[model samples]
Target: MNETQSILLASACFALAFILASLLEYWLHRLMHVSKKVGARHLEHHRNNTGQGVLWEFRDYIRGAIVLIAAMFFYSWVAGIGWLLGSLAYAAFSAYAHQLQHENPTKCFWMKMPVHYVHHKYGMWHHNFGLAVDWWDKVFGTYKLVDWLTEEELSQPEKNLLQLRWW
Candidate 1:
């Protein structure tokens, strides 16, 4: 292929990788809400503004590493260095954006503000499942705009959407 063709192909591959990874994250987030055991741990995440504790964080890191390595290998074979690098960038950005969205939503730039804020503040567990982007939530009819809840209200013992049977 010519150099221009190669670059276009690589760009397409990169875009595809990012879209696929985001979709996977969307589903995983939804699953965490559906399963009781998963929801319990995630509940702690909502209760504590910081994040999941060290052990769970470590587990997530391990999982991310495995996925990243596999993506690197696959994309390298399929679309050369350009796509592999793009996938790596996508993974890193997704991780950083998610952590920021949880730890301090105000500081996050790429994701829509207060979408995650509303998620945590209202325990709207099923609404905003998309981490790095809101496309899936929008596509799946789960996106909703919510005003901020008071701290006292946020602390109330409410039904988590994740704990629901049809979430």
Candidate 2:
């Protein structure tokens, strides 16, 4: 094909890859909950460690690094630089969001940690499943970011969510 045709094809590929990546993220995010055998550990991860304390619960950072690297290598192949950049952005955003979820932010106009705080209420395991963006949660019929606490838990001085306690 000619140079123009090649560029157009690449652009199309990028757009398609972007949409596919988004869809894949949504599916994978849900899978992390639904597939007990595969993501049971990750699911327990939330139950065990809510918020920033999660990063410390992993006994082996090497295993986590290996998983991340493999994912990056696989994604960078067909998705190209744009998607790769998005992957990086998503990782950073997820980490920040996780941090924000634990403790309220002073001014969180960007990550909106307070939006996630509601999920910290009691019996909220099935809600706010998205790690990076709320789009997937909203689409997958589990976008209840608001608090789902019992009257008893809400009445307590400190909400006692079933979360991982790193303290």
Candidate 3:
């Protein structure tokens, strides 16, 4: 393939990997609601309404995705690098999103509504499973729109969007 075609192929791989990561996140979260073993661990987050810090969350995501990343590398170096970068970017974004929603849902302006925030705030078992983005929830027909901000939240002092636990 020409250099231009190689670059395009890598770019496509990157986009595909990013999308697949989001889909995996959505499904894994959904699974936590139904599978006893998975739910057992996930229950702690619901009970606490807190997230394991962003770095830890990122690490967990990378740990889970390492095998796929390795497989991609074995297939093609260019595609693998693109996939790896995309996966890492998604992991970082998702980790931050999860922690931010837990710490200050109001700050998550990327989404029309922070789905994970609503999921925990309302104790929902079957809706709003998307963490990084709400696209999957909408596509899967699991998105539920509601007035999520509470009186307490409204009354609280405003916080900086970046004021989240990173470690």
Candidate 4:
């Protein structure tokens, strides 16, 4: 293929990779709750957010890193560099969004993320599994909009990303 054609192909693959990654995150997040072993480890993340420091969720971070590295290798082999790069982008975004969820950002942008916010708000381990988007959840009947929750109910968690401390 010519350079231009290759770039185009890679771009297409990147888009596909992003969609796949989002779907993958939804399934994996759901699995983490359903599977005993996965849920046990993931519980640490819940506990850490309750009162402990954010850094205490080191295992979650490490697991995400290992999975992303493996995914990049596999996606590159299957779809080429563009797909791999796209997967990397999804991985980074997923990490940031997850942290923001745990940090309990109050800003409109952070608060608007339906999936992660619902997951934390209700402590609903089985629902709202999407990371970057809610398409899959909506399709699968797992999406739970938090708009119904009263402001008082939402106050338990960090109100906004601005609450995050650098120290």
Highest lDDT: give the candidate number. 3
Number of the top-ranking candidate, with TM-score as the measure = 3
* Candidate 4 regions with alpha-carbon error over 4 angstroms: 50-78, 108-113, 148-167
Please write out the lDDT profile of model 2 over residues 1-167, one tens digit for every residue: 67686566546555554454445555665676678786777666567645545344222222433344245445444334444445444444455555555543322345333434554444455776654456666677877644334474345454223233342
Candidate number that wins on lDDT, 1 or 3: 3
| Candidate 4 accuracy as lDDT | 0.64
lDDT of 1 at 143: 85
* Each candidate's clash count: 0, 2, 0, 5
Among all windows of 10 consecutive residues in model 2, the one with the lowest summed lDDT is 57-66
- Overall lDDT per candidate, in order of appearance: 0.62, 0.50, 0.91, 0.64
What lDDT is obtained when candidate 1 is compared to the true structure? 0.62
Poorest lDDT segment (10 consecutive residues) of candidate 3: 148-157
How good is model 3 by TM-score? 0.96
List where candidate 3 sits over 4 angstroms from the true fold. Answer: none
Give candidate 1's TM-score.
0.67
lDDT of 3 by residue, 1-167 (tens): 88998899789888999999999999999999999898797988889999999999999999988998677888788889889888998999999999999988888899989999999888989999999899999999999999877796688678897898999
As a whole number from 0 to 100, the lDDT of residue 165 in candidate 3 is 96
The lowest-lDDT stretch of 10 consecutive residues in candidate 1 is 158-167
TM-score of each: 0.67, 0.52, 0.96, 0.71
